[model samples]
Target: MITIWGRLNSHNVKKVAWAAIEMGIEHRRIDMGGAFGFTDDYLAMNPNRLIPTIEDDSVPGGFSLWESNAILRYLADAHAPHLRPEAPAERAQGDKWMDWQFTFAEAQRTAFQGIVRQGKDVNDPQVSASIAATIKLAERFDAALGQTPFLAGKAFGIADIPMGVYAYTFFTLPFERPSLPNMEDWYAGLTARPGYASQVMIPLS
Candidate 1:
């Protein structure tokens, strides 16, 4: 059996859960983080005190793992090997998009947190910064999509999961977002994926 910890609304949790759906990995979930209280047992599992820790009793090396991307990569490396890559060149392409999400997509949302999540107005300087950064990144996103139907190209893969989860916040979050056709098209395509709708496209907190 596999157990996943964290709120379904959490972006990080969505990554692992969505990946599991993509890979057809059966798992259960525990409500934790946010309004749900953390427990001593969870701490014992992941001292970093983060949501989205995973426990797969059947995996060879261990029962649990933390860090959502690592969990996604691990699952991809295991059951959905085609979703990831064994060769260096293909792996490098995947890494590029993952790195871009961490560096570009994640950073562009800082103001979004300071504004919307904290209940502050969009005009707040931090909010403005977030929008500005997002506008710039939206162009980048458009360019990326222009080249590939998916981030790592053609078919959906591990490289698409992390940022794909993050992308939801941008579109659903209450705020004005500049129009970028490429990003919107890419998101629409992701929305059509079986696992994405089931596991990733849920109501936000």
Candidate 2:
């Protein structure tokens, strides 16, 4: 069994937990970080002090891993081949979008932190600037989605997990956003998945 340590409300944690459920992996998630705080053992496992660390006892000597995207790749490569594209080139497509999510997140960080975490006014300069930057990045994502049904191509794969997590926040933010039909449609499909609904589609906190 895999032991995942992180609070459920964390986007990174949600990615790992949701992927585990989608892949039918037997694992248990323990709430840690945020208000729950972290233990010395947790810090030892992830020296960076980040949420969503995983320990897989199934590995030869017990393996602990960090980094949300890396963890997603490991889980897909090790346990769920279906989640990964078979061809190297095809797989790289998914890899690209996975990496892009960090950039996307960074672009929206100020707004998300201000509005979601601190409850700052949406019209605040920094918040509005961040939201504008996020919209520009999201437009690029929308264009990509317009060309392909999924980020990686025709089928939903690991590429969708990170962005799907963010999409909830993007769509739910209390501001006017230009409509992107492709992204909206893709997000709609994600909402229908039991794993996504249970894990990603939650009250933002």
Candidate 3:
């Protein structure tokens, strides 16, 4: 059996769970690393002390693993390699979008929380700078999506998985968002996916 350890509320954890569902990888999920708190046995599973650690007993070598993105890659290549992309150029392009999500969208989230989630006025010079960054990043992505339906190209794939989860945070943030028609449209389509809705889109706490 495959055992997954993580708080379901975590976005990174959600990504892995979402992929598992899409690929139909049956596994048991354990509650830990949040309100459950970590125990020594949990430490045995992941020294990093992060949510989203998994132990797989069914694989050839039978090992455990951590790191959400790596888990996504593993599951994709193992069961749904089509989503992972076989062509070198397509894979490289997919890698770029994945990196862009972390480098651009995820990085700006701290600012999003400060101004949007915390319900502070986003007009202060510092807040404006941060919001501006988000807007600029969104625009860049809008331009990209204007060309392709998914970050990895026409097909929804591994790269879209991470980026799609990040969009949930953007949609839920409490502030006036810049015009991002393409992004909004893409996110809407993402919401239509059963995997996305099942693993993400729970009520915000």
Candidate 4:
């Protein structure tokens, strides 16, 4: 069985856990990190000491993987081929959005940390600036969704996973957001999936 180590509330852990469920892969998730506290045992598996590390004993040599996106790509390539496009060119489209989500998260750190973490009010200048920046990127995502039903094309793939996690946080926050029909529609579809609803659509901490 695949063993996953991370707290459920973590966005990164949700990516791996969500993919495993979607692929119908049996996994044992050991809660660690956050308030659970990291141990030396966990450190050996991932020197970086991050959440969402996976130990795949099914592999020939036994494998440990880190980085949420890397784990998603690995799970898709190994167990769920449908989650990734078959052709290289087609797969690159999914890769593009996956990478873009990382960039998006970094860009959103200011706002996320301020509003979500620090519990800043709307009047705070830092919160205001961060919100503006985040909305600007959301507009870009909306424009992209207008052209394709999914980030990777017509079908849902790994590309949609990360953003789906973030969308929950974005929409849940008490902020005035501009209406983006296409993005909202795509998110609605994601919410309809049991895997997404159980994993990605959880209450953000």
TM per candidate: 0.90, 0.97, 0.89, 0.95
Off by over 4 Å in 4: none
119: Cα error in model 1, Å:
2.2
**Candidate 1, which segments miss by more than 4 Å at Cα?**
60-62
Residue 141 in candidate 1 has what lDDT? 77
Cα deviation in Å at residue 146, candidate 4? 1.0
Error of 3 at 94 (Å): 0.8
List the lowest-lDDT window of 10 residues for candidate 1: 103-112
- Give one digit per residue, the lDDT tens place, for model 2 in 63-168: 9999999999999989998888988887888899999999998988898889989999989999999999999999999999999999878898888999999988
Alpha-carbon lDDT, every model: 0.80, 0.91, 0.80, 0.86
Give the clashing pairs for model 2. none
Give Cα distance to truth, residue 142, candidate 4, Å. 0.7
Candidate with better TM-score, 1 vs 3: 1
Report the C-alpha lDDT of model 4 over 35-114, residue by residue, as the tens digit: 99889989998888789899998899999989999999998989888989888877888789888887677767777777
Candidate 3 local lDDT, residue 78? 73
lDDT against true structure, model 3: 0.80
Tens digits of per-residue lDDT, candidate 3, 66-123, equal 9888888888877788898788888888888877777665556666667645766767
Q: What would the TM-score be for candidate 2 when compared with the true structure?
A: 0.97
Q: Which residue pairs collide, candidate 3?
A: none
The C-alpha stretches of model 3 lying farther than 4 A from their native spots are 115-129
